[model samples]
Target chain A: MLNIKNLHVKLEDEDKQILKGVDLTVPAGEVHAIMGPNGSGKSTLSYVLSGRDGYEVTEGEASLYDHDLLDMEPEERAAAGLFLAFQYPVEIPGVGNLTFLRTAVNAQRKARGEEELSSGEFLKLVREKAKTLQIDAEMLKRPVNVGFSGGEKKRNEILQMAMLEPKMCILDETDSGLDVDAMRLVAEGVNALRSPERSFLVITHYQRLLDHIKPDVVHIMSNGRIIKTGGPELALEVEKNGYGDLLAEVG
Target chain B: MADTAVLAAQTVAAKARPAGTALAARLAELDLPTGGFTRAARADAAARLEAMGLPGARDEYWRYTDPAPFNAPTADALAYTDRESTLFGGIDRLKLVFVDGRFDASASDALEGEGLEITTLAAADAAGDHWAADLYGKLEASGQKPVKRPFAVLNTLAAVDGVLIRVTGKVSRPVHVMYRRVALDADVTVHHVVRLEEGSELTLLETGGIGARSNVAMEVELGREARFHHIASKRADDAKVGIGHVFARVGEGALFKSFTLSVNGSMMRNEGVIEIVGDDAVAHIAAAVLGDGGEGRFHHDDTVFITHAAERCESRQVYKKVLKNGAHGIFQGKILVKPGAQKTDGYQISQGLLLDEGSQFLAKPELEIYADDVKCSHGSTTGALDETAMFYLRSRGVPKEQAVVLLVLSFLADALDEIEDDRLRGDILTRLDEWLTSRASA
Candidate 1:
């Protein structure tokens, strides 16, 4: 469902390349976990795929279901079934969470030539989804991510991903700064949304999250390029051996 | 035949009087005592206004707001007439009506609440009970030229009959004063004095009615431990114009709050002067001006004086304006502290949101202090709605107009939240929504 061939991304107006000639692909019905140390360009790849501002694709062709992903706007990419769970979500004051979610869902729906959801229908769906994520109905009425705890913010991101039901989901450090219980809840939420046609790219620094949402393939990234690819056992190897050996091997 | 001649002569005499002379004549007829005071005080106040004159476009304080209309030669002289009654949309509260420069007893309702005394300054002056007189015209000579606004001068020179409200100790019920302007093409001016005694609490809601043109000035005195909540809403006819000034003195351990909402007017100016004179006193002044079309050419000037005469006084001023069409809005606020006024806290903020390209706004917030142990801060912001926020909402399937309305309403909700009265807040919000809806349709 997703493919990246020798992806080369660089910071705008700079000589340094963050993602240098990296290759990866995730087929339908698979979850791929990418683990690496700091400065491994994990976030840059997500940003480049999500079409965020100020990230230039120096030389790469990223395709999501045969459509060029880098050419679309952020909202267009979102409508094209691309969802990025931000590590630090932006706090939008005075914008209700339900309102934001409804907007996102409707945008994608409208782009797909589907009927827009009325307020009543939207509220009903939101309530049902919120219940599943342990998010109270009252929290949906508050400003998006405003005054939300660290755990609640992560859960809220997951809730949005579930509502949109995107085909390609990128979780950027979803387990960072989360407690054990919150991590379990997040993993459960993500697991419930898995399907045969859907794919996910889970980015993390620790292998603990992989225990709940086990990935089909584990890849170690060092200095932008994928160094090694293996099965779930690769995560345990990184957890015990650290990235020092992986960096030496990649170089 | 003799009666006809006498009537004709009276008419000729009234016509021959100079512009604003009728108001001056009426002032002379009211047998009210000049509150016994030093001549120097009154002279000083008169000198300051004379020096300042009517603020024109050249004055920095009145640059964006022009007060020249009040001084125009085409303005009609003040005259009383028996006109149809004005309605306040069925508010069942105390009402005080003023026509031209005098009180209209036939238009006023009776006050029946305990711990409340509502009467004319003329009657109080006749009985030698001069509480209102002593407090009246005192702010003019307070040596603060900034507070000596041109409208206050006009009210001082032409005021005839004024309303005096006295809330006795520990009263809870509110006093509602309705200032109705009925004269068209004529200059009508009024002066009002309100006193809240020690340990008393009162809410005063003043509404300005439709008229040709009017000028009003009021002085409020709060006693020790007293609390005053004032709400003023003014809606004028499209052709009508007005200038209003309110001066308040808050005593030690007292709390004073004023909320002004100006929705409709061709040209209007609301000047507020609040003084915290005693220790532990609090003064909160907030205003919202919503203007649309070419009619809403409104300006507000809020001047706050925190003397810190005792210690630990607090003062706050907040002003928000929403401008549409070719309408213009202005907000000028100042916070002042005297020497040795320790532990004083003063905050002032003025913000405006322009809805259209033709709409304009000017905000100026200033702070002047002599004490070092005081906390004083002032900030002002004027800008259009965020285009990014608008597009974000639009991309979500919300209509463009509805998105703009929601953003504008949210911008104003912060100010409206400060209003403690739910009914009043609801009324204002409804009016605002209606105005925004109509504008969208137009």
Candidate 2:
């Protein structure tokens, strides 16, 4: 469903390359856990795939469902079934969360020629999904992430994903700044949305988030490339032995 | 140099004119009350006004707005005979009409509501009402200095008949005073006095009609525990020129709110002076000015003086201006706190958004503090729309103009949200939306 063949991305201003040659392929019905240390191009991969501005794709191609991903805008990519759960979501003041979410959902639906959801039906669906994530109803009425705590912001991202229901989601550091309970609730929400035709790439620095959402394949990314791919046992190995050993081996 | 030569020639022509001299002579011929205690006050005010004169472009406060063209001598004071109905329908109340500085009795509607006393300022003065003295020329004598505001001084000097409405006690219904001006090429002065007695509450809606070139002034006094809400909407045609001033005083534990909305005019200067004279007094002043066309110039100056003479007084001022085409807009707001006025809270914000390249806006927010323990902040910002936000909205397939409209509407929603009256807020939003849409289409 998602393929990145030797994707090379460099900073726009400087010639410094963040992603030199990344190769990853995630098929349908499987969750891929990409664990890496800081500065390992983990979040860079997600941003490049999500089509954020200022990130130049120097070489190589990224395709999602046989369509060129790099050529599409961020909203177009979102409409084409590509979702990126941002590590730090932008705080948009004066725009309510429900209004923003409904706008995004309706934009995508209109692009797909689907009927728009009425206010009543949308509220019902949002309420049901919000229950699994432990999000309060009052949070939806506030400005988007204006005063939300770090954990609440992350859960709100997941709620958006559930509403959009994209074919592939790139969760970047979704476990950062979350308490144990919040992490469990977030992972449960992600687990419930998993399906045979949907895929998820859960990027994190710790193996603790993987305990809740079990991944079929675990990859160790070091210095812009995935150096090791193994079964779920590899995550346990890295948890016991640290990424320091893996870094030396990969280098 | 050529412009200065042309201006000198015009000044010479104005000075050599028989009609202009006659008008100026008639200004002296008018019997201005100068006998009682109010006479001394009016004499002092007139002398001050003569010294100040009209503001010029060189003045920093009046840089964007020049009041020279409006300073010409007045024409004959035509008795306003016919008052067209209210421009904004759905309003049912007594309407007072003024033309060329004279109140037209035939154009005014008599009041029949209970607990409401609506009478002319001249009548109130003749009756020797003690409350009349509390507000007549009160702002001119005691409020902020009009040393640089020549029009304010002129209004004081040429003051004539005005509407005085007093809510005896707590009143349930609102009092609408529609002051319509229907004469051109004439200098009109209106002095409105609104006295809200102790524990009284009322809403005063004042609308200035089209086709009037005048200098208007008003003074309001709120008694203890009294609540007063004043909303003024001015829509002048291209030929009209006006200078409007409002002075309000709030007693202990009283609340005063005033909003000024100006849309169409050739040249306009609106000033609001709100002084919190007693403890726990609250004052809120807001204004929105929308100017279009090269010939239209609208200026607003708001001065809020919180004496803090008593403790725990709060004052706020918000002013916004939207300029299009070659129009000019200005907003100047100042907040002052006296010495020993402890626990005084004051905030002032002035923002302007210019739509056309040739359009300009000047915003000045000043804070003067003498109190040691007080919370006061003032800020001013002038800029165009946010490019990034506009691009984001347009990228969603929304048209360019529609996206701009949405962003501008959102920009104003913050200030409009502060309005508590649903009907007033809705009316303002509807008018604003219509103006924005028409501008976008044009």
Candidate 3:
């Protein structure tokens, strides 16, 4: 479960307040999509939730499974089962992808009082998980995100999500760089990981991604707050007409 | 480019300090070992060294690292118990052990092997006709014209007997030279000569340092079509001061590659001069250095000069240094393309990683091209760890220090990747990792 009560955030290097009094809640085993136009703080929400630097929370109370997310360090939040699929995956030269994956998997496990997996077991698990994402062995051997195509980077992000198996997954602009086929593959990967104990908060601009991975609830975010909460059909209405009508109506 | 004038002025202003007096006293107290030809060579070098004097603060070449520690009358050698017995203990090879700069016959293997002629400098001194007769102290004298390395000449003049190696055929196993110090306040000098005949190959591996203040001079000659690989690890206790010099001559179509890896020392310098004399020859000199961020004042310097004399020759120089805490690192490398050396290919890169704000790195990269048709490039960079990359790794659940280790290893990979031998590379990498782990714990 994830909870947020009037989350406010601002750019640390500038005097600009990006998020102002946003309230949202997603219960267990549910998928919520926040659809917003450009400059509506969609990306800032994900970055703040993932504990990125240069962003100060002016006032907010956010929690994941009764653990105060704001008080924990980034790695601690990750160990608490909070995962953020970055909009742009960082390219880490000289660090093999497999090594990155293993270190992350083991680090989270170790922080959570779980025994680390052996190299053999980890390799076997990764291969099996990667098989469904269509990521070949060579892709796993190269450095992280170095020279990977856009689609390949998205798939690798999904592969990482599958490996970490976090309880709360936040997908930020995942569909922005993906083509139709790539979007389908990413959606399939996300859909396969959905379970009773896991939840997702998908943030996107268009309904194209929603058509593949259906969300149980849709929230219309404007400026910095949620203006409306509706069912799946609200997406189609905005898809046919644009957010122009919705913004006028909310005003 | 000369520092003698500056040193002379300083001596005048300072009212005749011990700089000259101490050097004269030290040289007068010691006598060159008895060897007819090598003694003659030592006499020539001794006079040259006396003229050059010991390096001082005014010396251009010793600008970043002070030479005061090396000028001591005697160095206090630290007793060592190698955390690991030998550097390349996993592989079977010819292992030569030295204690306090003297060859340890009881701990060394036999002096002969198939396709290899190995003898001590003491034995070679008594013999009139030997393989190293022409090589002994020859390269040192030749390397002195462009640069004045008085310490190298000092090493040649006052050496305590080293090994002479002659390779006539392929040598599959590496010859590892192990140096360990057991006495305190011990100063030792050694000179080694290695000759690889035409079409022959040899790999030399060295680890550890000799006295508290030690000077080691190594000369290598690769004949036509021959290949020589040299890898040395300079490791000293927290209090030791050591310097190593390597002079190599590459013949026609010959290949010479040398790499030095350094882990901490109070004061340390590794200088190399590589000459490509014959056409189509290739020589590469690289080094990877690490110094701790501690109170011991870790200072490291790597000075390299690579000359391309013949047509179509290739030369490469790569130096990587990592300084943490209050450590200081210096790199000075130059690639020279002679007038007639057309179509020469030269590449030089020097990089430094400073772990903290207090650490410092000084790099000087040079390229001299007299030929019209040549391709030469040089670059130098000094930077801290990438905070974004660090965050990415930490966001993925890796801890902070481990992330640093990853990035540091990546920074050094460009230089470490130059090693062609897989097993040796792996061993050196392990040593690097060990250095990282130890520093982290400290």
lDDT of 1: 0.72
Candidate 1 chain B, which ten residues in sequence have the lowest lDDT sum?
Answer: B32-41
lDDT of 2 by residue, B203-310 (tens): 777665533566677888888999988777765342266777888888999999888777766677777777788899999888777777654344444433434456
TM-score of each candidate? 0.70, 0.76, 0.92
Clashing pairs in 2: none
In angstroms, how far off is B243's CA in candidate 2? Answer: 4.6
For model 3, how does the per-residue alpha-carbon lDDT over B1-442 read when each residue is reduced to its tens digit? 1333223333332433455565665565454565644756665665666677778888889888888887766665566554534567898789888887889989999887777999888777765567687888789989987888978987877786899999999998889888777776568788899999999999998886566677889999999999999988876462278888899999999999998888857888888899999999999888888888584778888999989899998888888898888888998998888899998999999998999899999998888889999999999999999877777777778777777887888788877877889999889888887778667645
What TM-score does chain B get in every candidate? 0.81, 0.83, 0.93
lDDT string, candidate 2, A1-251, tens digits: 89999999999888888998999999988899999888989988987887766689988989889779889866677778888887776565656688767777777787777998899989999998888888888999887777999889889989999998998988989998999988898898899999999999999888899999899999999888899999889899899998988878767
Name every residue pair that clashes in candidate 1: none
| Number of the top TM-score candidate | 3
DockQ of 2: 0.13
lDDT digits (tens) for residues B133-216 of candidate 1: 567668644524544466575455445457788888665555666655555554555667889899888777776553466667
Error of 2 at B238 (Å): 9.2
Best by DockQ: 3
- Please give the lDDT score at residue A100 for candidate 1: 75
**lDDT score, residue B402, model 3?**
76
Give the runs in model 3 whose Cα sits over 4 Å from its true position. Answer: A220-224, A232-245, A248-251, B1-22, B29-31, B77-85, B236-239
